[model samples]
Target chain A: MAAVLPPQAAPHEFLRARTRWHPLEIVFWLSTLLPFVVVPEYLQLASQIAIAALFAISLDLILGYAGIVSIGHAAYFGLGAYTAGILSKHGIGEPVVLLVLGAIVAGVVGYASSFIIARFRHLALIMITLGICLMFYEAANLAGWLTGGADGLQGIKIGPLAGTFKFDLYGKTAYSYSLIVLFLCFLLARRLTHSPFGLSLRGIRENAVRMPAIGAPSDAHIRKVYTIAAAIAGIAGAVLAQTTSTVSLEVLGFQRSADVLVMLIMGGAGKLYGGILGSIVYMVARDQFSGINPQYWYFWIGLMMVLVVMYLPNGLLGGLEKLTARWRRSPT
Target chain B: MKAFSLCLGGLLAAMFAASGALAQQAVKLGLILPYSGQFADTATQMDNAIKLYVKQHGDSAGGRKIEIIRKDSGGIAPDVAKRLAQELVVRDRVDVLTGLILTPNALAVGDVSAEAKKFTVIMNAATSIITTKSPYMARTSVTTPMLNESLGMWAAKTGVKRVFTMVSDFGPAHDAEEGFIRAFKEAGGQVVGSVRFPVANPDFAAFVQRAKDSNPDGIYAWVPGGVQPAAIGKALSERGIDTKKFRVMGQGELTSDEALQSLGENALGIITVFHYDHNLGNKLNRAFVQAYNADYKRNPDLFSIGGWDGMHLIYEVLKKTGGKTDGEAMIGAAKGMKWESPRGPMMIDPQTRDVVQDVYIRRVERVGGKLVNVDFDKVRNVKDPVKARMK
Candidate 1:
């Protein structure tokens, strides 16, 4: 099979035949390694990036891959946080179990709502999702007996991971825990994207009518993906709750959902890896800008957003990728 | 068969009579609070305090069982207060209603409660104007204007000359800034400048810079919540602004140990005005602080204390009324009623229905690795006759 192929094909064949590393691939791996050694602060920033990446990735799956626009993704995030909090308050200390239960609850709620949500498009979808989020916020307030109400769920003691791994104050445990969860989720997302199921989702995104005609189960596929994305978003929320140990009603606010959407679009949707990069840049920019001018930081962020949307339409990563492609074509 | 029918009739009549007696013996209390959204923390604190009171009192006040029902206001959103009040009255049919965290929320609920002829208790909100506008509303919490005016008076008395004020765009904060400026100016102090920022402002550098450039004798701020003090203090410190150069005064948990840890020593020497502080040397205050710290591992802020006191005050009135749920009876009982509070003797004013309480002027100090109230002085016993600047 190798002999019959061209020289380029031969190289591909050898790489497919054996695990041979590309120079670019090696450099990418090394760059990840370099951060741990040279820029330790980046690791702390990277942990936040990972959590935000998870959030954006969840949104991307629903928005980019499933062709669904959710303006209330924070509903699931907030729900997950409250669930973890409520559960912990009731003496359930296992972090993994709490995380799982939180995700599952959000997923179930998402699945139930997907029927109503899947029928709508654009503005209607946005409004309906926002309505649902507001409903949750109101309900959380009303159900003060369970939710601890506006005072928030305080004095939450997350004892340990599986009753063993204690959470430390300096964010060491939190960073590692978030990193591990993010890595696993990333791998899972990669596998899903490459799978036949993900390709079916892509087909639905391209042409919903065509996919249904071709026996692709478009509505069911969309619903399933939406539910999965919500579950992932719930994981992000659970992680946040574990890290902060205090979940406020602001988690379900429209602003948080908007932030995730912005991050997804800013990172270049559909590529999957863009979410991580976007979250990192966005958070770093926010931190730096706020540090520079606390009161006028929003102005700088708003300005940057305008520039990104107007000039780099596909987002920072997409623009860089395009630049890299051009550079390669022109031999630098 | 006739004898059997008569016995059945007698039994049915007895059951009905028993239920009626039980219903008559119980007093129903309603609490409307923002149990969700941003104000949830305050609501929960109120809820917990009420619950603790109820548990201690055995759900009975003055020989009658007490039935407490609470509804969430959501926030100071349009129509939410009315809806919550309607639910409390129409569904739960509570006799006495209480708990409003924001000024607008208190006003909204106060109207509804008055219309329904229910005794309303304004808990955690510091809207001084509400009591003046509505005779039915009674506030257990300190008023924003009163607190601000006190700060201004204190500053003036301490010989502060030119003052710059910064505050959130909210009504309470706006009122605080305005009231302080007015009082400070009245006390022969010159107003340098004033700026209002949005509540969700994450950065305070511009405001700090503006204040610095103005070169005021003191800077007065009215920013609340846990985040504001830290953010403002850190920014001020980073800008090399000294607290000694200006008198920083406001309502916040920012000067607390938890906030100081995040803000560092920048919070030190900051003067703050409030009705209650953990350092107050009253029996109730000492017990409350000790119990709360033992329970929550954190010092109770004014919000928590206010919540606890609001519940206690309501309970005291209910107990005095002999389980009468009538609005008139409860109102009469509440007026001129004195209670031993965390801030000492608290009396409900007969006319305005506002609490006549002592206000404290505290300077923030780092004690045992925590920012706490040190060098506190009881500046004045604020009474209702002072007349809140509402109109």
Candidate 2:
């Protein structure tokens, strides 16, 4: 079918900007370098943080940019994890191929589910997405013959990255692999957010009715973003599966989705760096606090979250950005 | 006053100097438990028991100061438990890894311990497959079938020809129920019917009613943890099915203090078979019970017994190795080792790394106006039946 241009106002300068790389992005990436120098033993934890960051960023693509609220994002994550795990166990042991396959499966699943997801808003939207995730969780549980049920899909052995650089006990390979993937995905997300499609999605997010009036296919854009986001989340799950060498039903759990949401909100949703920073802060804090006192650690985390929500509603990153902006504007 | 203060400072300095000369390497033991969720109560009990063991030994084992580090599993998520295990191994550099409540957490940590080659002693996890999963893993805990092996055979031998089974639908529950039914059937009994309910389900009236309608001579029930076991016992009593026509029997934890306290008089005369009983009439058990009660102000349950024995086993291993923390050396030293546990004589099977111990059959009866397990018979030298069946 032939496409028609809409009678709309001139695009904003922010929309016209092709690159979303801020100068601070280098500092963000550099900060990750310190873990290798200071605490090389914590590369496993760093890898986990990287994977979670990727998952949160995937959510940021749809939830932050397209204004869709999903409570079941782990559906894609678990899907990717199980797919990679099952395939690797069945002799498809190549890590790169397993990751790509995971993304493909999760993307297809997300695209199919997004049709119904895009038609609703608010509570209905949340419930439907949650229902889909719950269904997957139950399916994984009941298909004990294949998924291993509560015991988890065990004995998943992945071949080395590109047949070199094997995953080690210290998790050097896993950390590097996940960081590379996250950066690549972040770059794609950055470019997408500044592209015409990303702007239309943002416009739809701000006013879906106005978007349709301006002749933009809001539903199509939302579905496309959701599918892409699912693929990225799947890649995150692939990282987790390859790194951990096991996948369980907890990967698809409500807690996984909720934890990522908390990470994104804490980092600052809608911004690219928000997910990365939020994951680092939340995961590292958990590792440290939980180590200090396992019994009462959650209480401390809960208190910090409460204080953050109260004083910094835009999250730590967003709050810091506002503060810095204000300071710079006032010539201080 | 200045002279007295100077004397006290001299005393402190001498003590520090003396301690510095005698200081040996600290043995860092990391205990991972579900300290915040469904298994939290069990975790606390086990933690206290381990602490008691350390306190009794003056906080050192084989001349090395025993330092304990704890990590919470949150009871449900296995991946989080795995990461924590990794942290304990890589960051904390723990000499030994122990303590997890659920089977999944054990398996998750088992993978980490296997890869990292960390000495792991499972305290309370009852899954049969954990030992086989990791070379570094050895369990002081009993498997799921240990409790039911004697009870089922005895029920059939006692002329209970037809049986109904009800248990929570899960991995360990299935193991327990299968153990009972297999033994009962082997002893010439028929399982007339079976029903399963969720572990978290509080109301068991419907399931109880269904079992009653099946008209079996006895019901072989197993519900571990939570209030579900109490609810099931209450439903049975309220339905008047305990009035001679039907027999109710289960694993010992069904009539645990938490369950018995809630089930009250309704739990009276319920038969069960477990590895550990508070009223074991042994010197070690009597001392353990007295000390545990004095310290925690509560009765020691199965999980506490597991933890107490786990510490004793670790202490013995430390003695054998002269405080070396090599995983392979510890595992080798643990195999075929016997100990006079609070429960009775227990030995770690050389091949399976699972404990071979006697199972006790008990009936819940009022002792000092409180429900208590009274020992009746013992199933001696019970090994890992899962591995045994394969052989």
Candidate 3:
């Protein structure tokens, strides 16, 4: 009965658009299967890349879609890692149970921290998140009896997946386990980003002040996304713990958070597939370049990052998307 | 996305091409060490030591020519070490694995070695428990506790009644401090006070001040790596604490060749204990040091000795097993084997698979205007009590 449409019509449009499957999505999922057939030896590397990608995607959920810039994302990751490690060390070595437990613990912490984080904007949020991560880092370091101090949480024996398919030295089981987790998480994230709630998050990200005028509880929406993102991050960490069977102080380190941030940016933030693509690129490049000259690998990595940031403002995926769209539009 | 995938595929192809050059008949020894960053200097020296040994031995152990493939673990990140260890095992198909400076990296690699059923020889990591993590693992290097106990006992015996202890706040530091304290207490020496400083602390004046305030006869210190020991020596000298008046005793790295270079006269007369000394006055050590000095234009350090001994251990085992790369056979050959190393005679304890070697107590002295460790006392067949006590 409305004569004219409101300014924010995309949330309604998103519902209809979500039903059709994107060809790119199918292609993306299918490509992951290639590693199993093509290079079975690099399964461990592939698994690590998947874990890092998941972490980057989690960061993207908050930073890219919700407009919450976090430099301390490792807080959730470390929490999840320690949770999985401690549980497995105590004999609860089932992968699913560990992932769920890790996610719950990290999600709870994220939800609690979200209340405080959602109130702040920009630099204050960054500082608070960094402070929280630092506190956890120190706690892990000081709790030597439980966490093994600086020596790392060792003696973790992760059992078989579904009581079958043992974690082989070749990492076939771990790769499949992480790939399936990543795929499921990606599907849920895809649904959320296309839903009304996700549209509201994007609305909040674009213009927070205007979002309030449109009757959206901006803080609550951001908080929900942040908690969801943190749960995903925890899952990534749990996967890492299960695959590696050990967690060191590096999980809680500032470097981990920074690396994820870099990965998210390089892959093109905002889009669902950007983080995974970016992780594949960054981790693979690092692996190759580090083998060439381990001492000066950072110099090469820095140069590549600079070139990407300078040339592609939206990131690698964004630039590629632009190129493909232009090609499709051109009279070829 | 397709373009990116194409690029990645190309890169992977290139990497595979580069890696496929190794011959199937050669015995590939995979060395994973930090080639850059904080531990790079020591790691490079260790690499050089291994290379020197191979070059001197005509590059053949038993009947097989050794081919070394190096992988850098970067730093202490266990995940990186674990991934690289897997790659070396599955992809590279390395016959033997060795090298890791950090304890965590060694532990991670040890786990990989155990899981993959590969023989891994540890050269530098001093964590006592690394030996127990994998049955396929053998440590040619000494543990922190084994290196420190001798100094502690010698200090107690040589009129150091009450001593103040200091160590950097980390795992190996804790091991060193605890080992020293235990032996000192057992030898009836009182621990006056102890303080742990943060790693890479720029200034040790406060710690030195605390030691002075403790009014102890000696100060037993365990500082972390990389010029910190030299800085501590400088700080002690600046504070005017004469070694003769109040003894400053610690592990060998406290006044090692690198520390002595920066320490100079300040480190002179300071007594410390270690498993390896450049001036051990033995035929093997003298030749090794001469060759090492001629090759690197620098003196040999603890890490260098570890790597040298590691090569010797591997060669000896290979000879015994007739160049067999079978993990069980290699491990069996290495067990309870004793050899005269550049440092001293060392034996692999069958129970622990860790080295039982002679620890030398050395005093820093200036010989011909060059500072070096002079062996004043020695403890023969010293074993790691921590490992002995492990169930």
Candidate 4:
């Protein structure tokens, strides 16, 4: 009804309308490139934000789109990071290959874990996810020879992208590499979320009890989206490990899982742009606040998250959308 | 949307860019430390020492005023440490990097230091292989093996022949065990037994009882400076292990203030070895203690001495290079640079660029109703055993 589609409109035409790019979305992504010309010094921070945004989007898939809460998303993230780190340490230093392998490893692990995840919802789902992350953290700590234990995995040598672009101190290569990967993954996520499969996922999220009667099994849908989200998160973690050239136990930390969730909530769930915008705000706030008071910067980040959730309940992006809807309630 | 995107992008780019638009005349030093977390106290002590050094030395070396940029790492977040290092080198254009506490954080910064060819002085990270990670790095902090190896040999020399070893399982703890066993065996001592416990949130009751049951001449254990010391001390006492007869030896933490508070009268005869001690009877140390007390109003620890010497080395190297901040020139001058520190005479080992200092053997005894580790003997000019054996 909202789309004003004719009763006889073809399914393909409806799909096309749903997949059409918003002007703001296009402009927003394009603006990420401006840092290359304007602020070369901040390319490092830019790349980190891009990776975090990608991570947040991955969480949005399972948590926002599928209505599956995950508190231990870092399991996939850490797996992907450690995969890249371990491979690079063992002489498999190609960046592109490492990224692919990281995704594959995380995807496989996510698929294996989805059996347990698909059986639970809400409180149970959160507990299982958290427990899995704790297991990974302990395993990494116990296997000091492989993961470097408390000292962290050192001497991770990520080879140049395309055999030409080196990871420089200025972070020009790292930013470009991260941005490209993020865009490719973002496009895939966008396509997947626009299909009939995505509609089924929303149906399952809206009413799991009625979804099975309509031939959309909630478990299957959750499994598929959770795996997809894990793979995307894996890509993000790979980007981070490759760019930084070091991986620590903190990659598997609960703090990371919580922070990303906070990001998604602040930006608005189910809105792709919301996830991206939230990450930018959170990361930039951290960079700025830490400069003023490095000792208590976390306090500022916490306050900002609280303010966003309080004033804009559904999130900043939701609030913005509502305000825009009111401003142009009818076409001129 | 384009307008908003442009505005957001412009604002961020402007902010980060504005930070870099500072005057470049001063020699900038970027201090990356865990300033607000579990290790905050250690950061505070080390930071205070760096400040005190600048205050005493008038903050200028070789006609260049020192500009400090402090960054809080929070905790053992290696990625943050690495990113901060990169930012310091590229954005802040810092001449030297210092004040890293955790060994892992230092390891994370090693790549940046190597790539940028930035001279880095590690003030407190104690892993022996840290200096090996980057040629541009030099450590003023004592390595794990430096203290543990000295303790092992000293214990053997002073007639404790059989020993049981226990350490919290981690990188430095492994180093501690390896150093002690190798030195003890080399000095003609027998290791009766050994055990490793979890590094985080470990209960020492079972481990302590097991070590006590081994019935060795002494027990050599290494746990980091935290609640672990007090916990282990309580465990040892609860197991009825007399500290007077059967010696409990370690790398400083065994007789720390926390251990004394927990162990009580049982802490009377426990022996430990370390590079720096507040109880050292030298005039320079006394002055350092006095000045530190006047300024910070707290007793300076081993971490403080490391930062003090780090700042001193930075100052001396800058003076020698006449304000050149290049990695090669600074390191060249820093190597084998000997000075009389508050702790004692120390030098930077020319080949390895690691600290070579006196390791003191101290016994906990009550003096004027206060529990203190009084210095009984010393090992002069001890080098990190790992690097010494390697090269």
Candidate 5:
């Protein structure tokens, strides 16, 4: 039997030391690397997964970490994508410049919109976001000359990343670029989660009244987080537009927003790594099921969603974490 | 010196007369289509076909230059179409507008185009009601009821007595399915069951299962675009459903050689009604098929051909009217205009302003691992058919 030790048994006996690297973490890292070892086509798929994961992760930051639910997150994503497409079409093709511009545009929109959105509860916020997205969709269709209207903005020529790395169909460069961006964003989010501000956010989520009572401006913090999340989402959109070299009105559609929410919920919203894992699982399942039977694949997906909601409320990643915890606690 | 001055004056008079005889100003044409979202693929094909036609025929009508500016409606969604139409007419300041692929889009744009007194030529949309409802709106494609009625008559003649039907839950598909049901009944065929599926649904298993449970004498389906055929064909094959027991029909890019290859033998024996087929034995069609195949390395589908024909028809009208951009002159010239197209000779109805052309009933067959037209029969020249049913 292990001896019961005090919390400060040693100089390094803190929670950080106790959180040793688990086998699952090693497996997760290995699995993510697995796509790179496969063929070029698989690598392209992994790149898409990475971009999609980043988009979902941005949503997870606000929805899970900050306890804010957004139904119109695609607004920022689509806005960022279209901003890049519109700019490149009009002769601004530098990748770094476009990324910065996209983020700035999306962040400004988010900051402006958050003034109204941060005041609302879950349902009202969702509806308002949806309304804004629909408005943008209509506006895009109306401005045919600028946005390519309904046919979408096509034939977008993004010159090169930093005037060096060119995007190719094989997706080698795109994958690495997207992976790096995702990694950085993930690190920033993780750092935020562990910071004093992040703890205050958790405090706000736990009890809004108590956080303000302790002199924390919870609303301002939530709005700030929301704007940052939007900027991250915008970057993901820029990455997608750069890779695909085409932007359609569907990017701003309600379905896209819903899909991101579904991805976050399926992955384990509160966990940072869950977003990437969930996107991979969802996309792979979709590709496999659709190839097998195009008509009935949705039924299977729906069934799975129902099962997850009923049994594993915390999502796949959370469920796995729980299983691991239980295993560690039980006698071998 | 005085004689030379007279000669110069006479030459100037003649030059003025010639200039008066030939209209030489650029005519602005606005194109409104669902260019993005789910309808983006179809819109792209339509735009490509139109551009190709303009490139080959030159953008001059009569002697005047014609400029085509495109606007995207995003989809057949009504509100979006209305807003887009307003922007096209008010902002773009185009003389003539064309290209609406879905019924709702056509109707929405039609209203705005009429309100703005713009001459709108619908290239791909086929809602007959639009012409009867809005005088300013004229169509280049076949109407829903007319196409479905012909299909019903053909099915009756082919000894198909009972059928199961399904359509996507969109306005155009629903309208076409309803017309098919009504006409099939009138043509001595019984509709065993009918089902509607959501638009943009990727999976077809539940719908297919429902269809199998019905088990009618034949199946009549009206699904559009590339995805439907691929999904439907795969579902049917997995369910062990026989093609002979079904007669699928729809307006789709699925009839293309590439799409058929994807569907494989499952696409065989499927009967479809179309206005154009590359296999038709006509000089114009043969030339078009040759040129199109040479360029794209694939057979041009009906939508592409129809889009090409629409532009060609407009070009002919412009040439005939001496490059007039005025609504009255263009409309007058378009009436009863006859021209050789990829689908052979097509005549615009003087009364309804709809193109009356030959329609064909063809059965799909896999030859040398490629889907090609096997048995085709000329059904009818639904020329100037009463705009009554469209209302």
Candidate 6:
């Protein structure tokens, strides 16, 4: 199709068209900022939601778009956390510098691991990722001198955001900082997903056997996406550690990996907004349910998951798409 | 319809204003605990004690009306605990923070308390360095070194010379193991062998076999007060390392009533040390146990005392400050405060703001047709050795 295109044709014009911002997306982003005005007391929770959304997006990149189903995605997230936490503990308190360092370290690890990860699929891939996650968890557990083990990485003194906005008792600075990072990362993810590289990942997901024949190099695409996904997850972890100023073993626990996967699946996969939307629902529901009945909050969460899966297998975004399908542009 | 709706909205606004005014003067204490998940029973025991204390002593402490607010952390989630503390401070305007059940969660809230200057009381978290994290913090719970080190010193002092130590691989267990080892070595006792089993459920047969193979006169083991203790007890008996032949000793929880139930007669000779036990028959403790059992229909564990004594400390501080709930007043009044608790005489050490109390060495014995920790020996005025060295 590209070879037969006329001189006046723009390259990947359909991709650009799909990437164009929906009016609702603009409204959604603006509404995120509304918590600052309307519910400033929940700034800490809002910030946590932002971090979770970023993490879910990272998972969606590989699992949703690249056809990789990883339950141990928390490996990269925890890696990023420990990286930032260790740096802060040692007096490298600058948040941005630690964040970038966290990304680089996790991205490198992800790139190396992807060599093995790219070869496997389905059950083997799930077990391999879970095994890797357990290794990191155990490593953190054993290296109590460095990682602080189950006691958590303590004495982490994260500096003020941009050397100006101190994280106050009200969490004004932390929420804003997380929101900014989340926004920038969201933009990068959106741009990445709409590119020819992202299209190759989709093709690989849909038809791995045919994608290699079409010169897409399925392994390379999968590996690249996995690396980026890990890097993004690292950023999310860094954000969490920086904002909270602590990292416990739970960051790398099996529960964390499982929860993120659940959030992504509940939000829907493949489409870009599914992960973010799912995080919002899941996090908010958790906060509310736990508030109402902390002892049995998981029961409510489980019920919601069952309901979402049963009624809307495609997730909240999938349901929304169906409702608004008639008004939107049809896929070419 | 519009007039009726307007009337209903006005009534609602008036009710909100009225309730807000009523809640304003009440002294709010935010209780954060793992009220769900694996630690649910721990939370329940402590919470039940808190309720018992409130029932015995009227809710009002100092000059103000008391209000209790509960937040369930669910587990060792430091991030969630910190957020709950923040919410307690900013949203609920709580005057004090309490009921922190995990060390990491306590440390996390310590940051919040230091920043917010809210007087925080450690209820059950026992890590020694935790109180050092916040100036406004004081601990009612006993530290690992306080109990374990004393137990080790006594063991060496009495008769146990050669020992093998086996404990769970975690911070508290490591702390306990180190204190026991150091104290025993200082007293000229030789440690035959030591190993940290996996933090979670370890294969008891293998671990018990390894300990037995060491061929030591004494086997010191430390695990949390849970199902693991019973399993370890069963494993030890199965391996023929009975308390009768080889001296078995550890933290008090090893021979808890539930562990006793499972171990039956095997739990009889096991020796352990701790600050509080439901079976301690002191006058105050008898009263407390009677009341607790009457109300909750169960024996209050070590956690129950921490919660009970913590509430008592709050009441005393409130009375001292004449109901001043500010950080400075509450913490200042709390320091060096001596009180008679069900645990016996306990003082909030003025220097470290950690608990100083009597640690009793008890033998689990059959009394009145049930297993009970019979207090046979004691170490008095014991400070958390780790923090005692600091100042």
Highest DockQ model number: 4
lDDT minimum window of 10 residues, candidate 6 chain B = B15-24
Candidate 3 per-residue lDDT over residues B187-291, each given as its tens digit: 999999999987779899889988998888899988865689878888888887987556888887787666777776778788888888778899999999999
Every model's DockQ, to 2 decimals? 0.02, 0.40, 0.53, 0.57, 0.02, 0.57
Q: Give the per-residue lDDT digits (tens) of candidate 5, residues B24-138.
A: 6467787776665576767767777787787777777777788877665656444345544554554455678788886656655665665556677888777665665356556
RMSD of each: 20.6, 8.0, 5.6, 4.8, 18.3, 5.9
- For candidate 2, the TM-score is 0.92
Candidate 1 residues lying further than 4 Å off, grouped into runs, are A1-332, B1-24, B132-134, B384-391
**Tens digit of per-residue lDDT, candidate 2, span B1-391:** 3674586479648854754675586888989998876668889989989989988976777678789999888876777788778878767778899997777778878888888687899998887888887998888879877667667888988889999999887666778898889988999999999988876788888888888888888988888766776788788887778723467888877877778788877888888888897788999999999999999998788889999989988999888877777788889888888999999999999988899999888888887877788998888999877778866
Error of 2 at A155 (Å): 2.4
True contacts kept of each: 0.00, 0.44, 0.72, 0.69, 0.00, 0.70
Poorest stretch of ten by lDDT in candidate 4 chain B: B15-24
Worst 10 residues of 6 chain A by lDDT: A1-10
Q: Lowest summed-lDDT stretch of 10 residues in model 2 chain B?
A: B14-23
Ranking of candidates on DockQ, top first: 4, 6, 3, 2, 5, 1
Against the true structure, candidate 4 reaches a TM-score of 0.94
- Give the Cα error of residue B329 in candidate 2, in Å: 1.7
How far in Å is the alpha carbon of B266 misplaced in model 2?
2.8
Give stretches of model 6 more than 4 Å off: A1-11, A326-332, B1-24, B200-215, B225-227
Compose the digit string of candidate 6's lDDT tens values, residues B178-270: 999999888889999998888777458887788778788898999876578778877887887777666899998788777777777778789
Which residue runs does candidate 4 get wrong by more than 4 Å?
A1-14, A330-332, B1-24, B200-203
Local accuracy of candidate 1 as per-residue lDDT tens digits, B121-211: 8777775656654555677878766777777877887889998888876545766787788778888889889998877788999999999
Residue pairs that clash (backbone atoms under 3 angstroms), model 4: none
Give the per-residue lDDT of model 1 (tens digit) for A1-332. 11233556654463353233346544743464454456443444445566788889888888877778888999998888888878888888788888999899999998998898778777898899999998998787656567655445554667776565655322345566777787788777766765667778888878888988888898898889989988988899887777646565667778789888888888888767677767878877865664444334667778988898899998888898778778877964
| Clashes by residue pair, model 2 | none
Q: Highest lDDT: which candidate?
A: 6
- Please give the range of 10 consecutive residues that has the lowest summed lDDT in model 3 chain A: A1-10
| Residue B390's lDDT in candidate 6 | 76
lDDT of 3 by residue, A1-332 (tens): 01234557664664765645778778888999889889988999999999998898899899989889899999999999999999999999899999999999999999999999889888998899899998999889878889888889987979999997777777888899999999889888988887888889889888887898889999889889999999999999999999988799889989899999999999999887889989999999999998887667888999999999999999999899879879877977
| Interface RMSD after interface superposition, each candidate | 19.1, 1.7, 1.4, 1.3, 15.9, 1.1
Query: Would you estimate the TM-scores of all the predictions?
Result: 0.53, 0.92, 0.91, 0.94, 0.54, 0.93
